[model samples]
Target: MVTKKAPSAQTAVDVALAELVEGERRWAAIPLSGRRALLDQVRALTGRHAQRWVDAAAGIKGLAPSSPLIGEEWLSGPYVFAAGLGALSATLEVLERGESPLDKARFGRAGDRVTVDVLPTSPFDMLLLNGFSAEVWLRRGVSPAAAKANAGLAQREPSRTNGVGAVLGAGNITSIAPLDVLYELIAHNRVVALKLNPITDPLLPVLADILAPLVEVGAVRLLTGGAEVGGYLVEHNSVDHVHMTGSARTHDAIVWGTGATAAERKLAGTPKLTKPVTSELGGVSPTIVLPGQWSAADIAFQAEHVATQRLHNGGYNCVAAQAVIVAADWAQKDEFLAALRAALAQAPARHAYYPGSDDRVAQAAEAYPRAERLGPTGERLLITGITPSPAEPLLAEESFAPVLGVVELPGTGAEFTAAAATTANEAFAGTLGVNIIAAPATITELGSAFDELVENLRYGTVAINAWTGVGYLTPTAAWGAYPGHTIADVQSGIGVVHNAWLIDRVERTVVRGPFRPAPRALLHGEFALSPKPPWFVGNKTAANTGRLLAGFGADPGWLRLPAIFASALRG
Candidate 1:
């Protein structure tokens, strides 16, 4: 099928910027009912081409035709679109019923801050996410009363001018760009001008198809090009808000000048671009493993959990675990490490699809001269035991590759968790994702101590016994770093996204998972979940499993359950 070629970069930018000028008004004027109907249409359109999207993304990345790694494409591609649309649909449904955005959500107050249980919005969410739950903790001084009063900011302040939002798309995740656009539209009530990352341009046609309804309504405009085009768009006078999914370096370059000029400006607390820029930048995210007694099976399961955190998407995710923080005095540290090595060894590695991955891997090696590169037996290196340079690159830069490091802290038990939190907060430069893998007993033992530790972690999304990306997939769970970011040194960018609840004041989200995998033989249990959850690169039937799961979510019926269950079992 011959497709219409994208216009020249300059022309694309001109067209996008102009379209956004009108689109923002049109979008803001669109009622919740209209938005709901359009989103329903978009969901159907997205569901129609899930397979072609997976195939195109997978094949272009050099993944084998039958490779389970294609699951990454399906999950990050169609599944996210379907899930995000469902979330938006639900929010619109609430508005249609003349209720607040989080009307049914249970809100709790802890001292001055407000806590909202946003996930598991329905019994179906509980069933879909068995053994998993998520909650959003509002920023300090945000009382539940204030939250309740200003719950639906977008809907309440519809006449307010949000102008236009320009989203600099991430090349890796196929869902990221559109998902970010959705946040800007539904949460901020702004029209979006999305510049597709040049690397993922092959998926642009697919994206255009998925977003056709919005595009037709003049609510979204797609542009494509390298840095030059992005540079032009960011500096475009009409662009009011900027949201990007890339490195901090890219953020700085866009908000400030490049090289010495940028450094000087950063030091002076000055920025070249003075806009409300929001970004989900890279970070040195660490997964803390608390010292605890564990059954052999539990050890194996958590090991896979850790491995999946690092090896997912070949560890290219901004939220992927870059370092493993283990308790130094733990008796089973070596046992868990061995199990992790074995799990990684069993998992297959694909090409480092992202550009500059090799350089990033080399940078990690340079940081720890004695580091040994471990692997999943393919064209990749999982760097282990990197000397921690808290202020420098290894422990600061986001290594967007299948590279990981292990650090064993001297602190143990609650002390260990506190120390790990300190390291994650003080050492890592970005606050996008944080993971803590503690046994249920450890959490219970720590009690309020664990809650305090979580409160201090300083990430947009925090997960226990699960990858931080779980927060990314949680629609109601806001996805982005904690607030208070400056353009000079935007750690994980400014502002947040994936906040389907339309909560204006968000601090962080906590997603909890089971310590062990669900039972293998049956579909129903205490921990029923999507097989290997498409994020796992090792699941052989991930593509089919993800498609079935996506289809089920888009148009769920009892008939689809059996096929989804069967495919999930295959994985």
Candidate 2:
């Protein structure tokens, strides 16, 4: 096996800290307008290099050039970043004015606003926009107080004690490192030294070039390496706040040192001294399919829904629906499973990106000896009859593969909802996103129960009808659920990512899409063969829409309606 190696600790720390100081100094001197201009440059450059970026990422992931995953990575991925730019542009405008609509608030005295700015569009925007909204709502509606806090954080000098941030990036997603750095720099007004996970080190230079504006502003710096490099950066003296999007084990090792040190901390009831750290770790997200409400079409639509969530990016996502909790007594249970099996069987087995994934599947099989295997890669879409043992690894652990285990419960809508909620709350993982699929009438009838169930879910984001992954792509939806967690209990993660406007957040977001099929949609089965046909809503279409939406976003007038209809019709 060829294990990717990280940079030496001494070199990693020296380069990282030096870059940090330089970035902080440069960022402090740059005006907000200059920052916005730089961001505009990035947006322009991203458009120019869109194809190259998509191709490079697809190549690394071993995806076919014409694969739907390519379109997804290209269209959905970059589009999310573009939306981030729009949000950041709006935010910068507020910062430049030194006073926003937030100043008229009844509570909290407004201070002389300092203008701190960083790169605008990137995946971080998706994290920030959602995080801000969730945080605002958690604090009880959209209050000017939270907005002011966000603005205040943005304006603070990066060299300040609370302003230096260390971001440890994940290997799977090419955009994760940049997004992580962007969030800390733009949202929190922090100078960032990002440590790249070794798995994706080959893309570091390309990522660096793409994020050059932030690097030029000294707001962001990229460091590459493995365990030692990560440890050195996280434990560095200058680093005040830290964030990571990786495994729970990595988090624990960082928060409470490994081996004897970890044991000592556990026994002492207090961790060894450390600065604040936040993360968005992995999870075994669950999707609950309500009984009796779904028709055969509904079952098929939802089967694809769950399949897309699980198969997207080869099931490496933290929010990938890992478990399906359904009503055992539902008349259509078997039919639904059969359809799901067929749908999954059709999906080409993805490259098992993470190491030891096969072993994880083996472990799951050991727990559920009767698990059904699927696909040519031994990538079993395991179906487990509800097992009596809660200690079973299939039920307790995150398999992090294409494998899914089904647990059945006896109930209709309300009963199933309650049971699913209980299962989600009691699950060992802290970071989770629950998805519930039911008919419109069923939703209306059991609105309160559904709401209660959603509220009771411990996961960060609860998606209804749509895939929870949609929440990650939508700038308006928050990503991570658990906050204030260090690498120690990084169940899902500590803080939010992809939020563009950098609002303090609480709770997960609920993404709701249309229940039935849309005839003209790219995601429809009819369009599956060519989801990214020339007219689809992707990078190229995005450029066309950007020109149209700029006018619409600035002024929503009926004059733009024709263009909007044209775009929709073309798709």
> Candidate 2 regions off by >4 Å?
1-9, 99-136, 140-152, 156-163, 269-273, 388-390, 483-488, 520-571
lDDT digits (tens) for residues 16-104 of candidate 1: 78887877677767777888888998888888978778877886688887777777777778887788888878877877677777666
Clashing pairs in 1: none
* Model 2 C-alpha lDDT per residue in residues 256-350, reported as the tens digit of each score: 87899798896775765378877777777778887765667767766777777776677777777777888888888999999787767766655
Worst 10 residues of 2 by lDDT: 528-537
lDDT of each: 0.79, 0.63
Error of 2 at 562 (Å): 11
**Model 1: what TM-score?**
0.93
Question: At residue 445, what lDDT does model 1 achieve?
Answer: 95
Best by TM-score: 1
